[model samples]
Target: MRWVFLVLIVLNALYFVWEQQQPSVHVQQLPSVLNPAGVANIEVANATNSQTKTLDSVQAKINLTLLLGGFSDPALIDSLSQRLLSLDIDVKEVVVEEVDGVDYWVYMPPLVSRSVAVRQLKELKARQIQAYLINQGDMQNGISLSMLDTMDMAKDLVQKLANLGYTAEIKEVERKQKTYWLAVNSRSERLIDESLMTELTSDFPLMRYRQEMPQ
Candidate 1:
């Protein structure tokens, strides 16, 4: 009976040693793959950044300008504006002062009196020389011989008048003309393609244009 009890105690001690040698079963916590709060914040931030980029791109496109110029006639400018309006294109009118050409005026200086001017005008008419009596301004009581396009023509007329025993002077006058332009946004430039340009030219045969940046 004593030997049986000793054998039981030995079996218990061996079982304890075996349990100590076995590997530990520890439980580790893992990260969640579908965290609602974290996912919502990240998605909202990405969407906001994308939307801001798109708005900036559109703003850059809107700031550019296009200019179409060289329209001389007011009536033609009006028609073109109406045509652009019909096509839903925004346009603004711009006028630029340009020097068209020079004109030379041949005339006689103001005479001593109005009676003297009239007498000289009559003498010119009797001699078959066209003349105009100056009625007002600084040249009052003077006689205008003619307005010639070229300086050479004016000098020739002055020599002819001198041969006829008449004094004539030449005055240079600058001829200014107003040029009309249609200002459009760069975004609208795509709408004015070759076909549209051809149609516009057919409608306005005298319309000449050049493109430039906005001032």
Candidate 2:
């Protein structure tokens, strides 16, 4: 009985060794979750990179202010500002007064009363002579003939008034000149467009411009 039991045990051990050397028949597949998760993460990272590039592109465009100036004529400045407004551009107008030089004012001495000044003004106008009555200041009730740049020009005007049977004198005064400017703000290339520049230069020969960056 003991011999038979030993033979049986030896046979069972040999069977276990044979099973360990054989290939598996009932194989189970993995869920493939890790590969899909990795792919999803990579896609999210790519999308984030794309968004960063888009933001960089937007940030690269600069907003600038263009200063258009060198204009002396008020009428021309008005025309230019209106033209720019029509193009849908943002524009701000600024008028600057500067001391140009001295001027000579040709006028008559103060009259006795406001009534006399008004009568003289009407008479001058009726005679086709342009004159203004000074209603205020030290020259109140006086007659203004013209504003001249030099004493010689004032004397000429005085002589002309004398020939018209009126007395005139000259006084020196400071001259103030006005300059017009436009500040245009935009983020596009419209400020430096060739055709627009050509149009502006053609219309206003003295129109000039410069650029100012934002802070």
Q: Which candidate is the best by TM-score?
A: 1
Whole-structure CA lDDT of model 2: 0.84
lDDT values for all models: 0.88, 0.84
lDDT of 1 at 191: 92
Question: Candidate 2 at 137: error in angstroms?
Answer: 1.9
Per-residue error (Å), model 1, residue 116: 1.5
TM-score of 1: 0.55
Per-residue alpha-carbon lDDT of candidate 1 for residues 50-94, written as tens digits (9 for 90 to 100):
999999988765665665556888777888889987998888988
| All-Cα superposition RMSD per candidate | 16.5, 18.7
Per-residue lDDT over 163-195 for candidate 2, one digit per residue giving the tens place of the 0 to 100 score: 989998899999889888887776434655888
Candidate 1 residue pairs that clash: none
Worst 10 residues of 1 by lDDT: 60-69
Model 1 bad stretches (over 4 Å): 1-66, 95-97, 185-206, 210-215
- List the candidate 2 regions with Cα displacement exceeding 4 Å: 1-98, 177-215
